[model samples]
Target chain A: MAPDQIVFWVFAPVSVGSAVAMLFQRNAIHAALFLIVNFFTLAVFYLVLGAPFLFAVQIIVYAGAIMVLFLFVIMLLGVDREESLVERLRGQRPLAIVLGLGLAAEIFVTARASLGLARGPANFDETVNVGGNAQALSHVLFRDYFLPFEVTSILLIVAAIAAMVLAQRRERTTVEAAGEAEV
Target chain B: MKTPISYFVVLSAVLFAIGSVGVLVRKNALVIFMSVELQLNAVNLALVAFSRLHGNLNGQVLAFFSMVVAAAEVVVGLAIIVNVYRRMHTANVDDASLLRW
Candidate 1:
């Protein structure tokens, strides 16, 4: 087997295993840590795929920013207590298990069917050689995808404002209730 | 030797399945949110794999956009969770059922 295949075999299990562990973890902080492990493994996969720019983004965005946000929220809420396993909706767990298994079966069968016809990996080195991953990515992103880029900025702004508004309203209501009690 | 693309695709599918199950079975709103992020990351993996397979940059660009959207989603989702916890003193999704008659 090639070195890439060896790397894939090593990291893929680590990624999937951590993700499964994350789901089963009762403590939110522990779950978040498992997710960070999965994210780092995925970043390694990105590097193997020859997308160095994406590899960097995967680490910085998902692992750095997003995981920190998750950790911060988990800490702020102090919900690190063990989660109750009580079924919120009857039969949901059984149904989810059945569905998950069915989906996995379908995917495996499809993969098996296509395995005979799959072409060997094409040459990605040529693409990566075109002025490097970061340079090539920016050329496409800024030149061809400029509009969507701008739209994303607008969406981020709107989401930030909405979150602030929602959080502030909750605070205002609680303060008002406290003052009314004193009155 | 070259690695076939199907392996990556199958891996992505498995991750996606696990994430879906997590969303269904987990009651904690934060865990459910994390599961959703897992699902998005699975899709990103597939996109990057395809980008490599096709020897093009389009799929990577789409993945980039997806990352931006995921970031924006995190901001709003965490804020909502915080607000819910503040009101109900819990982050259980079932506990926030004010609209249920």
Candidate 2:
């Protein structure tokens, strides 16, 4: 088998296993650690997909910044809050399982339904080779996707302000959750 | 040599399913949050895969933007979780069901 196939086979199981392990982990910190493993695996996938820029961003942002934040919050909350996996709601576990399978089927069909998608990996290699992957992506990012890029800055600033407000305000009112403008 | 795009599509589907299941089954608020992040990462992986298949960078750009959104999301989300814990003294979603104190 090709080295590409080998890498894919290796990381794919590892990623899936770690994510599955995370679900079973009652401890938040352990789950966070499993997620870190999954993130690193996805970063490897980014590199394998020829997204060198995204690979770096994945590590710096997802693995570094985001995971750190998750860990900090988990630790602050304390680890003893391990959840009891019992299904209080009748058939909740079976229901969740069925829903998960249905979601996977839907995603599979929808993703594959698109036409013009390739069978094997694409060959933007020449483009990527032009002064390397970073240079090529910079062109697409700055020129083609300029407007959305600029708008993201606004979204980020707004999110920051919302977080600050929510954290500072002392209240149990669930209305404060409106500030939860998450995603 | 390149791996098949189908591999990534399948992997992403499976990962997303796992993430959703995690969200549904886990009672801990933080674990649910992590499950959400896992879902996002699964989509990101698929986006990168599509970017490779199309021989274009558009998908990657979208993925990048999603990452930005995710970062912002985590910040606000964590704050909300912390606040919920402060008031209810527990981060379990079922326990914090009431909209108000």
Candidate 3:
């Protein structure tokens, strides 16, 4: 196989397997750990795409910062693994499965249709500037995509306030749990 | 010359499907959260693949934005999950019947 195909072969299975493990693992902590693996694999994928900056950013921002937050919540909440996994599927599960299958099928169909229409790999020589850094990316992000950039900031601010509100809300009256009734 | 975009697309699609299944089958809120992250990563793969295919960095730029959004999601989602766990003492979706149907 070719080099790019080799890269895909290595990272793709890793990413997909971790994702599956993240789903089926009964332990929340274990699932989060599996997600870290998935994120690292994705970072490798970014590197292969010629976005070295994004690769580092993916690791630092996602695996480092964001996943730490997840770990913190998992430790703080002390969510029970056995009980959490045992919960029965609700009525919406069937619908969710159907929707997901439909989405996957649509993508498969599109892929089949576009089989021979694959575009050539981008020319790094023409796009590469003095240092081959993310020059074009910086230009577009600042110039053309500036509005979306600003909008994302606003969206983040909104999400922050909403999260704070959620975390701070107090329960005026605590209802006794059901399992305790047996004791 | 051997870098076919189909491999990337197939990889991403498989990952996305796994994530969707996780979201559908898992009851633990944390697992569900992780699954959603997987889906986001899958999309990132597709974007990066396109960027490589077109020889432009626009897809990479979009992927960066996606990363930012994912960071925001983790912060907000973790806080919300922690709060839910505190009140309910469990993170099971079935137990989260604040709006029971």
Residue-pair clashes per prediction, in order, are 0, 0, 0
lDDT for each candidate structure: 0.88, 0.86, 0.79
- Candidate 3 global lDDT: 0.79
Candidate 2 ranges beyond 4 A from true positions: A109-117, A120-122, A169-183
What are the per-residue Cα lDDT tens digits for candidate 2 across A11-130? 999999999999888778888899999999999998888888899999999999999999998778775766765666899988998999999888778766763245543456775436
Instruction: Assess the local accuracy of residue B73 in candidate 1 as a C-alpha lDDT between 0 and 100.
Output: 96
Q: Give a tens-digit lDDT track for model 1, residues A1-183.
A: 888889999999999999999989988999999999999998998888878888999999999999999999988999977878888678989999889989978987897687643633455666443878888889889999999999999999999898888777534578789999999
Model 2 compared with the native: what TM-score?
0.89
The residue pairs that clash in candidate 3, if any, are: none
Question: How do the predictions measure up, each by TM-score?
Answer: 0.92, 0.89, 0.85
Please report how far candidate 3 places residue A49 from its true position, in Å. Answer: 1.3
Residue pairs clashing in model 1 are none
Worst-scoring 10-residue span by lDDT in model 1 chain A: A115-124
> Residue by residue across B1-101, what tens digits does model 3's lDDT show?
36677667777887898788888887788878888888898898899878777777788889989988988888888888888888888888787888976
Q: Which digits, one per residue and each the tens of the lDDT, describe model 3 over residues A1-183?
A: 867668878888888788777766778888889889998998887776677888899899989988898888888777745643243545665676677777887787787678544745546635642256466678878998999999999989988998888888674443455445656
TM-score of chain B of each: 0.97, 0.95, 0.97
Of the true contacts between chains A and B, what fraction does model 1 have?
A: 0.70
How well is each residue in B18-94 modelled by candidate 1, as lDDT tens digits?
Answer: 99999999989999999999999999998988787777788999999999999999999999999889889999998
lDDT of 3 at A41: 90
Count of backbone collisions in candidate 2:
0
